[model samples]
Target: MSLVPTVHLPDDLAAALTRRLAATAPTEASAQVDRLIENYRGATPTAAPVLRDAGDAAAYAAYRMPATYAAARSALAELRARTGAWTPRAHLDLGGGTGAARWAVADTWPGESGPRGTVLDWSAAALDLGRALAADASAPSVRATTWTRAPLSGAPELPAADLVTVSYVLGELTPGDRASLVDAAAGAARAGGVVLVAEPGTPEGYARVIAARGRLVAAGFRVLAPCPHSGPCPVTGTDWCHFAARVPRSALHRQVKGGTLPYEDEKFSYVAAVRPDGAGTPPAPAANRVVRHPQTRKGQVLLDLCAAAGDLTRTTVTKRHGPLYRAARDARWGAPWPPDDQPDGVPDSGGPDREGAV
Candidate 1:
């Protein structure tokens, strides 16, 4: 079975985002959707100004919420699996647009006791929508999440929590601002807490994540997920490592995008780190991270792995490799692989070389 946790929004939250969607006139809603995406894609130092109007906010909810929710859930799934958690009692959702992170967390850990949290964002309208959705949640802990309106950079204060997530917010800030935000989020994480950061999967996005990862380590945090080691990154050049999650489009989403595909693949890059000192022991580091989706052929499988040596290695397994080949065939993106020398026990080159034939 797939280990990734599925993202299922509470019924009321979905209803809140879509409740007003049907009232929109197609042409006008379409234009709002276009502008929202354009502005967000090119955004720097701001993402809420364009979403001020209610229609635009609704359109954005239709356009981005599902994908963002899926990405957050996927990142958190990887983080929890690699580093066991004490079961967070509280969360701080930094720039959690429409409170997607909160929803994802609730779904990821739907235990008897849910997590109470806070959502901080610059947009009042976005918060309003979030509050409306949250009000529908049956769990008191989730419904009680506080929404704070404040600047993302140089903010006076942030909530204290067991988990802090800065999701889909880095794209709106300058490089320096992104770094500053990471620092702030790191500080907000209570000792022994976990901090998760996620961004688009573009090369530029990867650069932002890489820079933040370096800074987080410098700040004395332990790197987790999407990276198996604490040293410098291994993937380089045009081959940036990212993972993809499929998000099923809502009816409103289909209308807004003017597409028929039921789902869209959201490619994202993320980092989950912890304040290692007081943080409880983490799971033993995996031997390698399957950075890319495995490619399977008739009797062979090609895998791109980020090994513990901090380098990307392309290792191919053929039927002759026996059990290793079977495991490689089933490995998905963001999963881990065991350490095995090049077929016949060859030392791993760690260079950009073709996977040796099985």
Candidate 2:
């Protein structure tokens, strides 16, 4: 079952971060944020820790964790929906500074005692802040997290777990390290294990996600979201596949970003891959995915879809088709097509392409 969408940070985490930010001089915190932004935008692999000190870690947790948490929540939501009845008992968050992905996981699978989490990162400061914040978390999984200081180099073999997530960390790695990390992530998937990789929505981030997707597929895993088929991505040229998660900003967030908007949309690209369980089969993915926002015109709705046939196609539904038209109007971007109705996989009417009809 999918959990409710998380638009803001959990109250406990938010309060803890605010307290930490308050302890630091506002100027110092803002400066730390600026430096982190520059480093992240540079997207260069660093030989040393990015969050070099407690101030840097605290500022980052206050400034970026909400967006990272929201993006991870959205990606994991897709994984949950795609993998029916499959629940993770243990999770490993690779390069998971401050355990943002772990927070998302707790929300995704609430009330379950298991899915005990481990957050591994090279930055001791980040891990320390993360541990402090999680100590008061609402989820047992978050509170019981094992905060470990580990480097993401050498493509070291990882411990097998039910779930592994690599979020927003690929950009900081050299090309060789990035591939090695993806390989390690692939190898970490055990019986029915799932791997999720997320990156910024930038072109560079999309390239990283695509490369990881190829590696997972080659490793005998089945893709479960965004892509309806495991074949080559139909998205070509400059167009990239990405999704947006809206995060509510705190006052501190506004001060750091100099933005007045109460919420911001975090654009991210991701892929969720899974291995077969004891049944020796995986759940079926959607027949098609709404790759972009649905466009509604005077009398028709246009849906840009990644169809099950492993190709990009446009489906148009007009007023002539009453029910389907309404569904198309309500359809959201990044959701499966046909609106989960018509479970038989046939629409009320469609053209020869079988995408949709008037």
Candidate 3:
């Protein structure tokens, strides 16, 4: 499996963060980061804003933003691969504290004018810091992004947009609120729009994402990336579908986390669904999706896949398979199987169950 390159913070944003961190004492920032970690670990259905002040917000941006940005980028990449020629003109990011999703969107479709972006969150501190960070962003979209204060409970109605993103926010909402928020997103998204919900890769996070996926499908949206079919998820019991994004750690991130590692892999579960309102041709789903990293040993490669037939399967490719084996050797988790460039007319190697399952 190919190793995804470590995603780094944009230079402009990195400089902005450096300037913000320069004013705060390292020890104070470190202390606040520890508190944030504690809060996040047990932050389900938070009654109030976790970021209570500028200090807290700044600490969070320094520590969590890079990882969140990476995860969002990975999910967006998958969505873009499936939605060819579909560029969103407007983007709505719900509960987007530091505007990580907006950054991901802008990076995903660069060179274009970029989407008109708006980030809504309940925390004034987070909004303020996000605004400051985006004020001098190199990307025009980021510089022109709007930050608004709003509750996560889907009150006052959300603004209509071509793209809606809910990332790392569901865990902080009650069950009722989570459903309400997703419904609101479905209601506000324009026809042919896209809504992506992402969460930490933990089993609980996967549960939340899966629930949201069902809600979107019920709302008439078609499942895109991650799941090859709109049918029931084949992953059952102890197994959950998830992907990982490697994020390069900034100096402040290392200091705040107190770790020596130069990078961290942020595992995430996500579902990208589109409002198939008949504006364009309905895209075809992938033949299969790589659910796990391809495991290669000797002349054979073992692949765990979620097939379009609505099942989880493990297939093996031996050296004798020629070009197919080469493609298998280059396969990466979360990517479509038998990539578009692979030699045509390759025989099927995806039947029956193997020793491994995802």
Candidate 4:
């Protein structure tokens, strides 16, 4: 249940980024890299431009692409494990950057041939860069990706797709625009198809995801992950639901971002929902969700669990539990808690915010 995807910035893309950085003086490239970091920290739809030129775009690929790919990859794994043998034939990415979601999909969807996918974004440079990066990708889906330039707010109607992704792009939009983007994504999906949305793991990011979830539920889609029974998000108070994906960064990543952590944990909140008509049958549920990492101590392990009975509580496993204690000891962040257990009745993780069948 703990899915950690292997992400290396694609070879062709890495060469391009290196060339772009080399084209600039070291100081200039570093400054552009610095700006990418700063603008990313402060950017909104109307903010100062971030991905302006080759160097700017390269810096973006360096600092952001790995984490973006990791989050989407993790969410897709969770959805697929539940759905079983489902493979999307067509994909549409609204405001997808550098086609990261396409790569994530190519990794998870288990088709003999990859799906056809399109990436729509406002940055012509980003689209162009996306193409170069994916131009000779090994995955047919990434190679077949079409990058289109479109305004996020007033983009044209989307093509119907088997899978749709809107990742890390909602925070840049206004409230109205976020809702509109969600509507467009929801409308574009075929019945029983999936729509995956990911954002930063901050409280505000979770708030945006919560709003989008409401939109999806109202639009007749059912929650697929992070909730066993979607009656309501049973998690209340200041804590919000989110997940983490750890990804390895390349040498270029160190150069652009400075310092040297070989990897970074990308924290994100995502909702994967299926349109009622197309979702097929619901899968059997995991009995508990590991809402927090297990705390291992001498002869005992402590776990924060969201149970099948609709409660979030702490469970202590001592050496007496043997295998169970070892399993709890080795459990990772964002995995199904005690994966083998089956729920007897309804399941709940968050509180008072959603409604679905038990």
Candidate 5:
């Protein structure tokens, strides 16, 4: 006879069970777990892979995973050291799925008499995980508060905070949503307050981070880390700066996904924006000439109107220059509107639109 080993839930799971079960009888909780197991057993094998949900069993399991917490702690430490401020009276974790950011923040500020934190996410499941982590840390009294409301576009009308963090959440938003989140984060930071925004290190992810950086800069935040005041992201288009993180798999997580081992791969990037004490107004945009790409049959050019910064860079494949240039231009500035009726422009040899000069 062959024996299959039963997988045990991670410590965080046990803690969550203990907390939630505290309100209910152990027998009842066990029965509920059994029922959940049975439900999973009957689930169709062909079911689609679970999508990432804000507050779900999978998200909770992911938060409990060590890698996620470690990365968050590293980021927090870096931000704190750069800002030269130790104790924070209040902290806010935006889109803090499963309270991973909350756990990380509490751990980072251990034994510090000050600093209460609030974990805000759309999922009740995530809030439960946040509560569980807090309870495990044995500081539930000091580290209390969880917000289930979605973040607003402008400043959030919640409690004020000295340190605010938005981690691994911006990439999940649309462009407009990203802008709104950035604005809200800036507003949440009090004078001399710090706002840290982090995301995965993919092209799309970095692009979103860059967009947030722009908004933060406009709102009067200073860049604390990562050399180079401001420039194009260094990653190639296809490859991004992401890492593999291990997170414990729970029944809730497994029910949503199936087994676990290869944990989540989180691509992350972070920026700390701070408002200086007694600072009057934000600095003006950099006064650098927008570097323009030399006119080439196949090259991309990006123009920054505010800074008058432009650059023309060669692309991997010359064939993509037209589309890339058009995209770059649209991204930096609004669509170019040419005056109607002009000299007969030479048709683009490569395509219908390529021949015209803008």
Candidate 6:
């Protein structure tokens, strides 16, 4: 018996997908279809080894929540606008979770000219959810094609495509696994292909984004979004850059959390990298101005208020001293004094001024 029960697709979606499958089969598409079927058959409701609880249907549902899908759609739209007139015939969605990204792609790029996608994830339950969602969409008569029971560690040889999407999956992997996945995705992109990677907004998540950025850059990928490529992270390197978005949570999520509104606040870092015909080197960082500080007094330590908009502030250190350690670590003062007494009225200058010394 399978750990997860068989997933049933909505009649309309399933029928449409079957019709589309018939058109692509017999020679080239047969093998792909068969592989997908076999994988789905082997996938049980039970979770994979990597997840915390393979058998917890509620947990699986939360994992495949709809908020993620909406975000993926928004990200894809942003990518399409930036990448120009490139259209995809096939799509590979790594760590797709519930196949929300796949369904979003189908819905956004519908019709005969729209692309076909392969939803890849380690969880069979998640894949099952993806199939159901794809079938539910009002897309053209096309098979909601998918392959389950396939782990990212041993992903099958994938067909090349114009676009590839890997959203909200890198954080789960160890550093080594993250690197390997990126290398594989980059290698799989055809000439003039684009890859979109999205993750939660957190300091660690941003670090992963940076790592991905480095790997993609080294592999000759050009960044299309998020300007000022090289600089101190806006979040002070404490968290990733992210925003809040509204989306429907899955059935499992509702059952587990007992909430109806599927909206979520996710912190994410994303990048759309493309292999251009003749891409140039990344731009250099901009220059900033420097300012000097005034002299210190017996009771007052000079502080460089230029950076703080010329507001001389004082902070006391020892119990008997006026202020210390503002300009430098080794700074000390005998007592407290006003800011005007210091040279240039700037703080932290080392000049000797004994007049009105504390």
Once fitted onto the true fold, the runs of candidate 5 whose alpha carbons sit more than 4 angstroms away are 1-55, 62-67, 140-142, 151-158, 228-266, 278-358
lDDT of predicted model 1: 0.76
For model 4, state the Cα shift of residue 202 in Å: 1.1
Which structure is stronger by TM-score: 3 or 6?
3
Q: Write the per-residue lDDT of candidate 3 for residues 1-358, one digit (tens) a residue.
A: 2265467777888888888667877788899999998998884678789998999998999889988998999998889988888899999999999888988999988755999899999999999999988886889999899999998784449889999999999899999999999999888789988999999999999999999999999999999988989889998899899999888888878777778777888999999999988855886557788898888889888888898789887888788777778888888888887675652513544422244554
Query: For this target, which candidate reaches the highest TM-score against the unseen true structure?
Result: 3
- By lDDT, the best candidate is 3
Question: Would you list the rank order by TM-score, best first?
Answer: 3, 2, 1, 4, 6, 5
lDDT of 6 at 2: 20
Q: Flag clash pairs in model 1.
A: none
The TM-score of candidate 5 is: 0.56
lDDT accuracy of residue 256 in candidate 2:
72
How many backbone clashes can be found in candidate 2? 1
Pairs with backbone N, CA or C atoms under 3 Å apart (clashes), candidate 3: none
Q: Candidate 4, TM-score vs. the true structure?
A: 0.85
User: In model 6, where do residues sit more than 4 Å from their true spots?
Assistant: 1-59, 62-64, 154-157, 228-236, 248-255, 259-262, 278-358
Model 1 scores worst on lDDT over the 10 consecutive residues at 338-347
Which of the two, 2 or 6, has more lDDT? Answer: 2
lDDT of 2 by residue, 1-358 (tens): 1112336777877887787667877778888999998987674888899999998998898788999998898888888887776779989999999989998998888885857889999999999999988887878789999999999988777888899999999998988999999989888878788999999988889999999999999988889877898999978789899988788889888777667778888889999988767584567778888888887889888888888888888887788777777777787888888766645434544531344321
**Against the true structure, what is every candidate's RMSD?**
4.4, 3.2, 2.2, 5.1, 14.8, 16.8
Better of 1 and 4 by TM-score: 1
Q: TM-score of model 2 relative to the true fold? A: 0.93
For candidate 3, what is the lDDT? Answer: 0.86
Clashing pairs in 2: 89-115
Q: How would you encode candidate 6's per-residue C-alpha lDDT over 43-137 as one tens digit per residue?
A: 32233433322233223333333455555665565566444455777788887866656766765566765777777777766565456545656
